[model samples]
Target: MSEIMENPKGGCVLAGINSVLSAIHRTCPVYHSGPGCCMQTTAADQGQSGHKHSCFVSGVSIPSSNMLEKEVVFGGVNKLRTTIQGAVDIIDADAYFVLTGCTAGIIGDDIVSVTNEFKTKGVPVYAIETPGFAGDSSLGYEAIWNTFIDQVIEPSEEKDDKLVNIFGIVPYHDPFWSGTLEEIDRILSKLGLKVNTFFTKKQGIETIKNSSKAALNIIINPWLFKGPAKKFENKFNVPSIRFPGLFIGATDTSEFVREVGKALNLDSELVEKVIREEEEYVYNYLAQAIGVVSWKRFAVVADANNAVAFTRYLANDYSFTPVLVIISEPIYRQEDKERIIKRIENLEYANPPKILFLSDQYEINEAIRNEEKEITLLVGSSNDREVALEKDIQFINGAFPVNERLIFNRTYAGYKGSLTFTEDIYDNL
Candidate 1:
């Protein structure tokens, strides 16, 4: 008997290309697959991030071989070679990377050889065989790092003691990625530490090349990257800290800055001073929004990371109750699922939420309509707006595939992010 699939989240691999492509400005992702994959990546990115951070060749404008039946049966090497060469010649790009899909990856094309040819021509090329069938979009994220570590990054002789690199964020995958990174970057800068958020305006492709120079790599989440971190440590002799999640609220943000201070063995007096000033700034705006957060019940639909992070911020900072949480982060491994459950279970809540690991839109919509307790507020992707409307509750966009507002480096992280988040949600209500 065929096994029944319960609420299958439509799998994608092209999203990986967008993650890497968006990191650097003017970086052309020469898609080595058919036209459909390129179009899908372009369409998805345009719909979400096009308002502010959309790059030179994100969606349909991306260069592609657009493989056909004949190329599928025989090979797409010649077409790809032509495409890359033409792109390098025509497109004024800082870097050129290629991602392959099921068709080209299945055919076992010698992609490395082709990319190396352009590399020999001093074209700044990198390529990885990231097929949708290989894994989810997350794996494509891994591919980008792996290609950079193996191909782009060079050995560093000198390491900066105060320099740290931030890892674990999947750009474009998270709706507020740019703002979040910048927030953390700003906080770290305050502490007299240089930060490299791999995908930033000043530190995009350059981060890949200079990654070896950092003394520490701060992984923003537990479930992000290990292989790349390991490789980085092995090469540069840098230590790393695995922060549970992005520091969203005041207490959490203070704790993160303090912990990072401790990790780097910086002066306690200095760290405390910074935290005090930042917290004061955070709560100054927070005081005005107390009435908004007071006596409110909420439900959130988000990926596992946001579900946990936002829940902590809501409960700890403003006393908003999370009645139900829909964690949409894909759980392929039993351990990942259990980890999320344990994390949510351990969270301190006045009225804990009934958490569901769901991807089905129908199920998620139903979960929000609670007869037991009315959800006064919602924090999640744009899809949850309909449910919020049906329930006549206020909705706050905090996750991926967002619309109705543009996320241009606005964050719900650190002291500034806490204030920004508070004003954002409070103003909406």
Candidate 2:
């Protein structure tokens, strides 16, 4: 039996790949799919995500083969070759990636062979054969990293002890990705570490190529990049630390700092000093904003990473009652679900909210409507706004498909970011 998903958030895997590649500076994604894929993929992630688009190339501007019936019947190889060459000639990109759509994948176009031809000519082009039907947008994130591990990143004899690479934060898809990465980079910099956020600070293929020199790979998600992380470790000899979830507010952010410090075996004195300074900074703001907003039971509908961060921060940091939390992403593995459940359940003060693994909009709405617990504050994406209104709850746009807000360099991670998040909550109220 098949189920119909209503108003599902996020595009296919192609959109995910496109979003990632486009985020990198001077990197171009040349699509080898039918017409409208370029635009649809762009709209799925970047378009609805905080009204921001890639500065390098995105949306309709990206090159595509636009595989038609003729090309699909006889194979779109030659057309794809020309399209890649044209993109390489016109677009001043440092590297190019050929992303196949369902059309190319269904017709069995040899994208690897075509991309290899460009590679022979010293063109920095790679092929990602995974189509939109392969998986969701998160899979696209992992697929791109796999491509990097296999094709882009090179081994280095010397590793920088102070350098680290960040993973699990998908660009455009998260909407707050740029700001979140920048905030993480800013905090890590105070710890005498150089952070590679990949999507921010004009980092592109060159940064990725040299990422093998990083001392550690910090994956800030509960369940993503598992295979790529293993492959990265085996190939580059660099270890990784999984943070389990994105950190928000002082408690979790401070814990994140300490964890990173411990992983690197950094000086305990320096680590404590940094944590003390950051906590003091946050507490100062907390002191001023005490009782500004009334505490109420809240429900969050977001992806796994944001869902965990929101649930923990609201229940633990703000001392707000959590009633329901719908993880609005497609999570399959039982271990992953259990891990997410564990994090959401083991709250500091409040009881764990009811957690549901849901992606379809209809089911999500029905679950929220049928919740036994009362919800007063709702934190969700734009798509969930209507449901909140129907329930007459206070709603704030906190996750992806953020159509209402213009979110450039705005994040809810780390010490300062938590303040911004608090400010938004207050403002919304």
Candidate 3:
């Protein structure tokens, strides 16, 4: 199968093309750090929003890289003013986001105060303390969403329509995401309601501020978007439903659609039509690509929810017995924990995959050495891909490189994504 080989850890946090396009399209209450951080500017020259900071955002400009050592040492309150003011003067952003990098975090600079200072100017500014050392881009996404909800969004007394907010999508150019959004849009449309896919693709600031108007929220990945989902529920009384990545031809979509449908009291006929059509399209596609194999042995190493969903689906649908399952990122949310545990308990064989809670390369190597079964599928990062290659094993890099254009970036999200997934791994088969 198609496997990722190498990846650089830091750059612009949101690197996916689709993810960036989503952010630009929405013109949402979002900003990127300088090209230094994960928010690299790559918008085509179409309009002001598509220019630099406001380049893709029409009338918004993210802060510049003018905050120097003196300002960093004395605390960047004044320097922040210069940057924010300059951006404000140039871009007509609804609000400003003061994001932190590794240096800002190490210095313990008061981003909150800097944000308050900007707010004193009667401009809406929020502080997002996403240090590079702290976590990945997913964490940064959560920080951005949370800061927006907690600091900028005003609690409205009037209840609006029954729309649902779909938060936490970072529209990186993973081809799978396009199809995933299309499938989700179709399902939501069948419910006679529209969704606000903020900051992922075609999402913007107005869409984010109007989150209070949404009746419910659907979080695709809590790891990346937990900040916004929690804020919407706590402040607006909107319940949130979380899910792992939505892979193509996933039999589990039916249950997901059913749960959301129940909440909306949507037309069952339409829901059934969408679900049936999507599922069949995927099932038929997979049937042709995936054939019976002598070794059903598989292994999954991914983020918590992704690992749980993939391993369970592989077992439930493809009859691939996962003998080794490694959840690289530990389960943080209770719901995710429960979901993983439920799948583990339901495993047909009591001798489930050798489970390991891994944090880095050392842990993964140690786990591999202790494996009792010959691994047929290694699903995780390019690091694991290397390890598998060393052992002359077949592998698929589930998540590694943040950039897709660099490496024929393929994803496993949604039904159409599954077909691409099968194609990527076909050479190995």
Most accurate candidate by TM-score: 2
Q: Report the number of the highest-lDDT candidate.
A: 2
Worst 10 residues of 1 by lDDT: 1-10
Q: What does candidate 1's lDDT look like per residue over 182-285, in tens digits?
A: 88888889999998887785565777788788888898764667677788778668788877666688878888898899999998999999999988887777
Look at candidate 3 and tell me the lDDT of residue 274.
75
Query: Which segments of model 3 are wrong by more than 4 Å?
Result: 1-69, 90-94, 102-124, 129-136, 157-162, 168-179, 222-230, 244-248, 287-295, 330-338, 344-351, 402-411
Collision count for each candidate, in order: 2, 0, 39
Give the Cα lDDT of each candidate.
0.76, 0.92, 0.57
Off by over 4 Å in 2: none
Off-target runs (Cα >4 Å) in candidate 1 are: 1-11, 348-351
Please provide TM-scores, in order, for all candidate models, with all chains considered together. 0.92, 0.99, 0.77
lDDT (Cα, 0-100) at 20 in candidate 1: 60
| Model 2 TM-score, all chains together | 0.99
Rank order (by TM-score, best first):
2, 1, 3
Which has the higher TM-score value, candidate number 1 or candidate number 3?
1
Q: How many backbone clashes does candidate 3 have?
A: 39
Rank list by lDDT = 2, 1, 3
